[model samples]
Target: MYQFAITGLYQQVLGGEKLNQIEKTGELTSSRFTVRDFTELVKIGIVNSNTITAFTGMWLAFQLNGISFIQNVDVIFFTIVGSALIVAASGAFNNVIDRDIDGIMERTKNRPTMTGKISGKRALMVALVLGVVGTIMLFMTTWQAGVLGVIGVFLYVVVYSLYAKRKLVSNTVIGSFSGAVPPLIGWFAVEPSFSIVPIMLFLVMFCWQPPHFYAIAIKRKEEYAAAGIPMLPVVKGIERTKKSMFFWVILLTVLPFFMFDLGLVYVILATLLNIGWLALSIYGFKMDDSIKWAKWMFVYSLNYMTILFVAMVVISIFL
Candidate 1:
């Protein structure tokens, strides 16, 4: 349903350079997918596919917790489906909102939008479908879980796509809410209980997003500036962005000790992870920052968050 809509929306909404590419290629030889055919795919949720795949790696972390039985068949099932839907919806919305800007940027120029594989109306429908389904499925877990799903959708779609992303300054802060929900989703999945620990995980992600995005923004500062998008590197200097990244890495690393009753294993591992990030940031600050360096940090950040959350589950096991 969304395949066509996303593509249509992209081409009509954003008059990108890729259109010429398509024109030159004369459609038949072009590598890009067409709007009509792509939309027809029943398996429309690539976001769902990736989310479920990543969740598997992180799922065991929850199992390690002393709780012994974090994996209720129902809970895992619902969490995957819920998160998948939300993630898919958010991805669709992101494509919809950034259709024009994405076309403007070389890196994003090949997205469904730029390729004319989907339309605005269709893309919006896809987003609504995934967003609604994801939220509804959360009800299978608990009302709170359902609400979390809703919050994730709202944060990504409204706060990030509509509000923060365009404004450029502090947009990453607003977008971070969407990224921060994963741990809470996992926490709520089993416990359905609230505590400072889960909140701390949430805060860690919130702090982590800026630096992660700043690194990317710095690397792609030209692309963003050309699109009139206000990334930190473009708005503030790269040095300032590095300094900000350092501040968050420091705070996020130190924050866990205060919020969770972590033992030495968890504490040491998390601290090491934080320090590692801070070290990278320091290096990024000292040298003329490179895209390669930023990419490394970005990849490491993914590993760091996954590791930290898994470690939390482990600490909970022995306690």
Candidate 2:
């Protein structure tokens, strides 16, 4: 009975019209892997974004701890490169785990995993290699950062992807923990201790993810529903998702105040960014087209994180 049910599900997912479309597009045909395929498999964009935050944290740590970057260039190199590798590994693992659903979502339907450009076993091998090397590199910096890297991978691959992602509406929230760990890893690589600065940075990333992801959920509600993923927007409705986004944005607004060490420039810029995001969230309540509003929110969230993290590095350098 279980076998039959599994077969039925696969048939629904990969048979008939969808199969025709896959065949027509040559998506199911095995092909030689290319650099573009590798980038997609590892989700280079996500790696780059997370690496930026990690770099920001490391830079701030150097500034706050009065350490010379010239003296600790090795640590900086390892931390940045290791963070990127771990994040990329996580993305590859996610692609392997999510290939079934990836084929169903328009945005993800062309992923290397779904297109037969990279086999699942090969992807897993790549993930393992990247994760091991990344963890070792992090350990070369500090045990604290190494431990955080392992924790981040576990949260992302096991806790979020294997568990919460399909079973709970709070999956995005759960996944944010892993996403927030990069900066912590960076700080720990330099300082190897807990402090307000790193904690505030973690909180900044933590509070930023929900609203950012909720916007994606809203924009792709139908796909999420079809994929059987219980995203907040798909399960609870867009209005509820909007309210939640606002709540998170509100929480995010106060986090900057706690990091007064970042200087007045960071504070003001962060405050303005928060206000702009809050205003955008409020405007969502009035927008007739929720999809358009979600797109705006998603774009703003990207800009918000990029600008805020870059500003942190710049402020740490001059201030």
Which candidate comes out best when scored by TM-score? Answer: 2
Question: What is the Cα-based lDDT of residue 102 in candidate 1?
Answer: 76
The runs of at least 3 residues in candidate 2 whose Cα sits more than 4 Å from the true structure, single-residue gaps closed, are: 1-31
The candidate that achieves the highest lDDT relative to the unseen native structure: 2
The digit string of per-residue lDDT tens for model 1 on 145-189 reads 778777787777666776578775888888888877866776676
Q: Each model's RMSD to truth, in Å?
A: 5.8, 4.7
lDDT of each structure?
0.68, 0.89
**Distance from true location, Cα of 193 in model 1, Å:** 3.0
Question: What does candidate 2's lDDT look like per residue over 1-319, in tens digits?
Answer: 3464334334433434654477467666466889999999999999999999999889989999999999999999999999999999999888877876887899999998677777665677788899999999999999999999999998888788767898999999999999999999999999999999999999999999999999999989999999999999888999999999999999999988988898988899999999999999999999989999999999999999999998998888887
For model 1, the run of ten residues with the poorest summed lDDT: 37-46
Backbone steric clashes in candidate 2, count: 0
Residue 252 in candidate 1 has what lDDT? Answer: 83
Clash statistics: count for each candidate: 18, 0
Candidate 1 local lDDT, residue 96: 67
